[model samples]
Target chain A: MALKVYADRMSQPSRAVLIFCKVNGIDFEEILVDISKNQQFSPEYKAINPMHQVPAIVDGRFKLFESHAILIYICCAFPGVASHWYPSDLIKRAKIHSVLDWHHLNLRRGSAGIVANILMANIDGHRSYPQVVNQAEGILLKSLSKLENFWLKDGRFLVGGSQPSIADISLVCEIMELELLSEKDHDRILSPFKKVVQWIEDTKIATSPHFDEVHGILFKAQKRFRERMKTQSNLKAKL
Target chain B: MALKVYADRMSQPSRAVLIFCKVNGIDFEEILVDISKNQQFSPEYKAINPMHQVPAIVDGRFKLFESHAILIYICCAFPGVASHWYPSDLIKRAKIHSVLDWHHLNLRRGSAGIVANILMANIDGHRSYPQVVNQAEGILLKSLSKLENFWLKDGRFLVGGSQPSIADISLVCEIMELELLSEKDHDRILSPFKKVVQWIEDTKIATSPHFDEVHGILFKAQKRFRERMKTQSNLKAKL
Candidate 1:
């Protein structure tokens, strides 16, 4: 049986896992669990992942969730996966793990917080809180600075590696969510970190069409959000 | 050269790494980074782990941080580490990875939040805010309940494995931080999760003397906190 991938493309980690499989030519079926509709809460999907989160996998009878875990599994288990993604050298792999672990509360939190604030504001028809946005931006900047100053100091990828690792794919997908922000807001946030921006471009190029393909939903959401803001501003002017 | 573990016992993940080393008999030096005194921020420690977090390891020239990453490195690189701690089998290792990843934002966050609140209240000499305490408690209980209903549903350790894995050590260490709470508060938060409690005891037995030895500081702090609370209540009675 082909590996089963449960995902929602709008999710950052979900997109990372999907793109990884595509880039590696791993055989998998994508099963969408729509988060906007709260479909993940349904009993059936919960059985596959009791945590009710995305980017879970079912390879034959084996079940797993957590995108980093899934990515590591794919890199280790799948035959054709290049070692650069998650190298066999114990030291290199350990460094990659450090980046992934650091990412959870740092980069992931910052990007997800900003996007979530945008989402909640849009849904409730309220202006997003300035303080909350500022806090998220602060975290995002610190994370980006760390990448620029330290991780990206030596090599094109994180942890000073010559090639993009799973860390690159996972983190790039997270920064991609900034697409949901207004163009000005996005630029203000990301423009300061030149290396981070270049690295994102590098990861996207390496993964090519798959990176863009998995991100289609996020792009649509970004476009829709911009349109909605414009319509709201026009209505206010008429009033 | 012996593996150098730069850590503070007061930190849960720090204790996790220490216990794992002791349990597996991994030879190393424990260079204490006293977090209470802000030693983690010192230039020396930052050079070791720019993230400035406890539980970093320097094995020969290779330096790494993030407790889960450190644990994984130790398991893979060190000889004679029992396979069950981090098995060579791809699938089982993947499942363990899932648990470790789930822990960061869930169990670790909840436990750390509650402990932080206690520290703030004690340091500021003010009664802890009820709502903040309630929020942390809610997160902590939900985490423990998940363990009971899902992860602990099958075996002696997490992920349904009989022997304790790195997941077991990492998580059990997080739960142990609740010892910082008042005896009443600690029991109130933890008592309902019977399976989680038993598992904590099981992990303690498996790791033996090192587990308690490393946690010696936490136990002392727990005792002092309890006495401080008793004195505060007694002084209130005079009114």
Candidate 2:
């Protein structure tokens, strides 16, 4: 039986995993667990991942979760996957690990927190809390500053490599979520980091159709969010 | 020249890397960057790690940080170290990575946040804020409950193996900080988790003098905290 990947493209990590599998031509079945609809909480899904999170995989009796872990596993377990995705060089691999480890508390947390507070609030039909939004935005900007000035300062990719690595994929997918924000908000938050912007475009081009395909759901959802917000504002004006 | 590791024993990840190197017999020169004294901000240290964090390693000219990344580097870069420390089995390695990734936002964050708030308050001679402490304690308990009921549920080690991996080391060190709390507070928090308590002991035995030696500084600091608190209470009585 082929490996099974349980994912929701709406998730940043999920998109990273999906793009990785697609770009590498890994054989796997994509099992969608729509988190927005609470499908991940179902008893059946819980059996696959007790944590009840998306981006889990089951290969035979082996089960794994956490996108970084899964990404590493795919690189190590599957033959014919480009080593540049993770790299086998001792220092290079360690540097990628460093970026991924640093990511959890910094970029991943900051980006996800900002989107959840701002975009998810609109989706949930509630006003975003200014205090929480401000705090998230602060985290996001600080993280972006680090990415621009430090991580991407000397290289075309995050690990100072000629080719993009999983670290780049994981981080760029995270920043890509900001598209769900208004164009003004997105530009305001992102414009100052020119290097980060260039790296994002480079990563997107490197991954191509896989990146666009995996992120398709998020783009559609973002469009719907804008339409809903516009209609809500119009109704308020009429009232 | 031996690899130079910049560490402060009071930091959990720093302690983890120190213990891993010692236990594995990896030759490393320890360079102390005392965080409490703001020594990590020194221009020299910043040149080593722009992130200004401990648990960074400079192996020859190559520099690396983030404890988890450092741990993996130690495992891979060194020769003749036990494979079980990281393992060559694909699934086992993946599981270890899962635990390490889950750790950042869960055990490490929760435990570190609690210890920082409480211990730093004592160090600064100010009472800890009740609301912040309460919230942190809640997060700590939830994380410990998961550790007890989920991670330690099946095996003597975190990844369900006879031997402890870097995941076990990283997590046990993070929880070790709770010792800085008052005896009563420590007992109240830890007494309920029998498995976690036992696992800590098991992990300690597995990594002997190194674990105890690396932790000696925190233990001494904890003693000082108690002594200071006792003196303050006596002064209050005299007043």
Candidate 3:
């Protein structure tokens, strides 16, 4: 039986995992657990991932969650998946792990939470509180600066390597979530980090069609979010 | 030359790394990077770890940070270190990684940050806002319940395992930081999760002297914290 990959393309990590599988030609089946509709909270999905978060995977009798873990597993377990994604070299692999570990509380925290906050605020027809938004933005900008000045300082990818590791894919997918923000907000946030911008582009070019294809849901959502915001503003102006 | 470990015993992850090294009998030099004194931000430490975090390792010319990454490296690179700590079995290791990755945003965020908030509030001589504390406590309690109900339900350690992996040490160390909280608050937060409590004890027994030795700083700090809280309470009563 093929591996079952439980995911929502709208999720950054889910998209990362999906893109990875595609890029490597790993045989798998994608099972969508839509978060926007609270499908992840259903009992059936909870059985697959007690945490009810994606992306998770079920292979034979084994089950796993957390995208980094899934990514590492895909790298280690699958044949013909390529070694550069998560090399066997101890030092190189450890450095890649460093980026993955650092990413959880740093990049993922700031980027993912802020996008959700903006969307929730839009849906609720009110701006997210300035203090909360600003605090998250502070973390996001600091993380971006670190990526620009330190992680990307030496090489083309994070952890100073020529090839994109799982770290690059994970971290880039996180940055890509910023695209969900308003054009001005996105530009204002990303403009300061020239190197980070270039790195994101580089990761996209490296992964190509798969990367863009997996992220298609996000683009559609972005359009819908903007439309809703415009309609809400028009209604307010009439009042 | 032995491996160099930059750490602060007061930091949970730092203690986890120290204890792991001692238990594994890894030859290492302990270098204190006092976070409380802002020593982590020093030029020297920054050279070793640009992220300016504790629990960084310098193995000859190679340097690495993030405790989970460092643990994975030690497991792979060192010859004598046992495999149970991070098994080579692809499935087992991935599950452990799942716990470790899930930890950062869930258990660590809730447990570690609350302790810091309590300490800072005490040192600055005021209470953390009730709303903020409650929110964090909610996250912490929910995370503990998840550990009790799911992760520890089947095995003596996390991920339904008989042996303690890096995930166990890293996570148990996080819960141990609750020792720094007042007895009332600590018990209030952890008492409900019977299995989690037992797992913490099991982990302590599994790692024994090394665990206790590394945690000595936290015990002393806990005493000082309680005394300080008592003094503050007495002063407020008089006022």
Candidate 4:
């Protein structure tokens, strides 16, 4: 039996796993766990991940959670699939892991959380806390500055050297937040780093065969981001 | 030439790397990054890890940081040295990574940070905002409860499986806080879980080739711990 991936396309980690499966030719059932509706908390889904979180999977009898772990497992399962995705160079691989380790706090909880909370404020009408948003912005900017100044300067990709690594998968997940928060009108936020924008664009294609389908929801998010970006570019302009 | 490790035993992550190296018969220089006085901020060390954390390594021309990442690098560097240190089974390894990922937020920054802060509190007569300690406590107890439910039942190791994977390394680092905070008498806060104790014993012997050194430190910590544990155990034994 093929593996089963419990995911929601709207979830960045889920998309990363999906992209990993598609790129590596690892066939698996994509079981949707709707985050918008809180489907992950369903008793049935909790059985898959007792923690009630997504980007979980079950291959054969083995159930697993945590996006990076799942991605690594899928890569290992695919015997000859690309080693570039994880890399065999111990130092390079460690760099990838270091970035991933740093992400749980910096990007996942900080940047992406801020972007998501901003959107949630709009969607849920909860009074927003200025300090939280400010803290998130500070953390996000600080993390981005570190990544840019330290790792991304001359490296071909973040931690992947010339090609994207699993680190790219994690980065793509966090950068997907840009889709929700990217106001073209307010490009001042991420504007100085055209290189980063290009990298994000490249990460999108790296993770998928069909960019349109894989990034469909993000495209929708980008579409509605007119509040930030006045005119949505029709020419597939690099985000 | 052997790899070079920049660390101070006072840092839990540093100790994790040291214990792992000792256990695996690896030869590496111990370049102490004295953290007690905030020596990690020196320009020399900050260049290695802009985050300026310890437990980093310089292997030939390559540099790697983060204790868990360093552990993987060591395993890959010395593949034949140990097997179960980081298991081969997909599910087993994933559990280890899940715990490691969960560690920075749950254990490392949570309980371990509390331990460090409480250590400073003893000398300086200052406490972190109670909310921070209280929040960390909540996270730790919840995590400990989850661990107790998962690992104690398996009766084997820390990650609820047959062997001690890198998860044990991460947990060992957190538990090392018990030694660090012995003056604060926090072991009993976690003493409810026997597997934690047993697992610590198992890992010390398994990964620590120098059991005498490991026990020596623990013995000293216990000496100081016992003196404080007499009556104050009831006051803050729960931490």
Could you give the candidate ranking by TM-score, starting with the highest? 3, 1, 2, 4
Task: Report DockQ per prediction, comma-separated.
Answer: 0.88, 0.88, 0.93, 0.54
Give the TM-score of chain A in candidate 4.
0.88
Q: Each model's TM-score, in the order given?
A: 0.97, 0.94, 0.97, 0.85
Chain A TM-scores for all candidates read 0.96, 0.95, 0.95, 0.88
TM-score of 3: 0.97
Tens-digit lDDT track for model 4 on B1-239?
Answer: 88899987766778778877877779888898888779899999887778788888999988888788888888888755577787767666777787787677666666765665665565344665666667777777777776667655665676665556777866776766666555435665678776666777777666655644744655576566555545454667767
Error of 2 at A123 (Å): 4.6
Best by DockQ: 3
For residues A1-239, could you state the per-residue lDDT of candidate 1 as single tens digits?
A: 99999999988999999999999999999999999899889999988998889979999998999999999999988999998999989988998899999999999888988878976786458788877877887888899999999889888998666689999999999999899887888898899899999999999999999998989988898899888877876887999
The list of candidate 2 runs beyond 4 A from truth reads A120-128, A231-239, B120-131, B230-239
* Candidate closer to the true structure by DockQ (higher is better), 3 or 4: 3
**Model 2, C-alpha of B60: deviation from truth (Å):** 0.4
- Pairs clashing in candidate 3? none
User: Per-residue lDDT for A9 in model 2?
Assistant: 92
Between the candidate structures 2 and 4, which one is better when assessed by TM-score?
A: 2
Better of 2 and 4 by lDDT: 2
Interface RMSD against the true structure, candidate 1: 0.8
What's the distance in Å from true for residue B126, model 3? 3.7
Superposition TM-score, candidate 1 onto the true structure? 0.97
What is the Å distance of residue B98 in model 3 from its true position?
0.3
